[model samples]
Target: MSKKQWPSWGHGEQAQQHYLVEPRALAGGGDVRHVHAFLRACGWRDKTQRGGPLALQSPDRTVRIEYQPAGMPGGWTIQGAAAPGRDAWWAHLGAQTPVEIVAGFTDALTQPRAAHAPNVWAPLREQRWRRPPETEHVTATSPDGSAWVQYRPSAGGGAMWWSGAQDRQGNGWVAQFTPSTPLHLVEAFTAALASPEPVMRPLGHVPHSARLRTTSVSVLPSQLGAWQQARITAARAATWASTAPRNARPRSTAARHHAPTGGARARH
Candidate 1:
């Protein structure tokens, strides 16, 4: 069988932008849901899975897209939607980089010429549905700077948190983050590591690494931003104090590793 090729994110190193219009809007009234459904019907899945704006990725793992709703008054900003191509278009409507994708209207730059109006949706429809590859690593530092967590992308389309800390019993703890963990969730987990509580609380669905003694916690992406004030509280209370002494606190990568019970090997 022939390999399938999808559109690239355009010529620039940065993601070029484009707008999506409602299919039937030019005629009169229109709705954006049809466009959303068409994309879903074409095999896109909501990466977040939460009820919010759409965050979609191509099955071939070539594109990551964020789309706006029809009601938002101002033009929308899609942070992660870029792909290689001079232009991406819908048969009835189209758009290009920096183009505005309104709910019911396609911009002039992307509209296809009448001669090239053959089955526009065919390419996407025929695309083999597949999950995006794990290609990113995200990390965030704690407020006190004593500890940090590294969030590695998972091949299963979510994210895992690999953290370093020490238990009350002084055993080094190397735990994994829950699936699809968000920033705040990881932050909360880190904060818990600093808590004065004797037993270090688990964060997310951490799993034990047979090679490196560890445990897991279940975390919810829904609770992402909920830890802002709580994190501040923990920081004020010096939650990470149990890990190291005042002057001997972990101030760098080597120190964080030292703070843990033993050297932990990272899993792929």
Candidate 2:
């Protein structure tokens, strides 16, 4: 299938539409639509009921994803089981966590292959996060000490093995990756956490407690509308491609019949 392209705005216009907002002011559930689209592309089935949280299950029924728009403390949860009667691995992202960061985890989850021994802390270290030497467990903290990530190799007693927090005592958010959770997913999440790109949030949606610490520029309504339309278009395209008849071909391709009669193809 041909890849679907998302819409883009001029750099100057896009820059004008959005201002940097602290991660703490991030609103949850914003990425739910994109997450649903990708999972559907991968053959996951929606099983949500009326008035319930959005829920989807893997084709094999071994994994599930859920998002509760009204659930503040934990709005997003994903769990996987290797077999029946076995313990499940789970991950949680709080409501305030940025969707852009959460996308990192979901994107990795949908990849075809698992990463080999990914170093989750390397990305944070490269971003100048500090880690004390000789610690029993791996840990890294942001420069301003408002955020931190940790991994506990010995967490076998039902404790979370991988965890992160932003403004823990304030109106920020938290995420937890259980011991059985894939390291690659954790790496992706951390990589996004360390990214310098700022997230966009509405000024009114910014939590009152975080208003003092957060700063944001106004985003034009038209820009937001354009972005929403683009997202819908991409999702519809993916759905159509995934559900199309197996033997069907694009009309443009079907109409092509001439064999190449030109000189040597362009060099790679």
Candidate 3:
């Protein structure tokens, strides 16, 4: 995604600049490599962290994304197993989340876009979610109150995690996920990563700007047909979704995976 610097410090930042709005639905299934490629192709940098298993980038001032899996094995791990033989998991499911995601990161604009004037401009300005953080990570509580998770860039670029609040005050509340939650999120992302589609909005209706189909790109036929086929192959062993949902449920994807598959039969 295009570099999103902190809102420019100066005025008259209303410079006309071109930013890429990468179709988010195309990047999914723990396919960080592919997502990075897609963003770079569009002139965005894949700002992945050191050990994160997922890939993410700022395509433009319009948005930033945390390339994540739908279902990670452990759901969400508090303390990594390697950190002295400890393991704990939290089950986050069916929790309501706002549509526009808060993008608390910026910088790394090796390929700078032309800002029109002295006005400071940042990429990914398409969103309004705020509460910026001074650090690289941010913690958000699951609506169910069952879990308190951290949303931060991955180590090498794949997934994210945090220690439970109940476990620690502020110490273990944040960190990358380990083997603990990998499989759980893998399943969740595999299920959620799909083509763009219309969706129900907070107003009890579909917004004119909303895409009704699947949103994650990883689940799209253009990329993960075989991967999904394999997922179906191991469907029996797979469990339910993780806390932070990647996309809609199976019924949701089937309904919007393009050609009228599962769910209702009214073709779009």
Candidate 4:
């Protein structure tokens, strides 16, 4: 069997720059997108093609890891921010899995670069290791019974909402929002359902009415009776069908808006 060729180990140009080059092959040649997502999930921003050279920079922009892959040694250099300057910490990825590669890179960051570890890995590990959010799903209907929206808890800290209003053309919009977003925005979104004409807003960035400066309230799915649950589902379907031009009808004045169990109640 042939032995793996590793990169040379030595100190970087700067006197204070620490360097460790080890041979570590990936289990399967590393998947760049997977690595990028994992890093992004950890709070590392992709600075590729952003001035200077292409690289992934830490949130503070002090540390950088250029995406330069070398086939000879089966690894790449990891540059970290140091007090005096940046240090090059190279690894031979040919011998290690992607996980091990990141572990080693993180472990090698000590002393001058110690702060970088927590600044990067702590958030990364917290996101990757922590238990995912437990979501309680529910549906919200508009006051006129002409529009409805489904709210579901997202992986991170936010809510994903989908308009239950389908036009005669069978089109609608889906939106993901952060907790900080104003509730009025959502109300405005569902309100579009009753428009005499089809809502022309793009689904990707649905426009909302003027921003409400009030603090956004939490929306939770409440326990519901079997009868109420069935009615809610039926209403959502009915509203979707009513979007057709031929089916348009007068809005009911007795319509009541339904808020998910844990959501804030509207005050008269």
Residues 189-241 of candidate 2: C-alpha lDDT, one tens digit per residue: 88888765545545355444433243334444455555555544544555566
The predicted structure with the larger TM-score, 2 or 4, is: 2
The lDDT per prediction is: 0.30, 0.62, 0.28, 0.33
Give the alpha carbon lDDT tens digit for every residue of 196-242 in model 3: 22221112221122212222211223223333333233322222332
Model 4 lDDT tens row, 55-92: 66665665565544444433333444444442322222
lDDT of 1 by residue, 29-132 (tens): 12333334434434545574576545655444544445444333212222222245322211111111111123212111112233443331222123321222
The most accurate candidate by lDDT is 2
Structural similarity to truth (TM-score) of each candidate: 0.20, 0.68, 0.21, 0.25
In candidate 4, stretches whose alpha carbon ends up further than 4 angstroms from where it belongs are: 1-26, 50-54, 70-74, 84-100, 103-268
Candidate number with the higher lDDT (3 or 4)? 4
Residue 78 CA displacement from its true place in model 4, Å: 1.0
Error of 4 at 24 (Å): 9.9
TM-score attained by model 3: 0.21
Better of 1 and 4 by TM-score: 4
Per candidate, the number of residue pairs that clash is 21, 0, 62, 11
lDDT for residue 134 in candidate 1, whole number 0-100: 48
lDDT agreement of model 4 with the native: 0.33
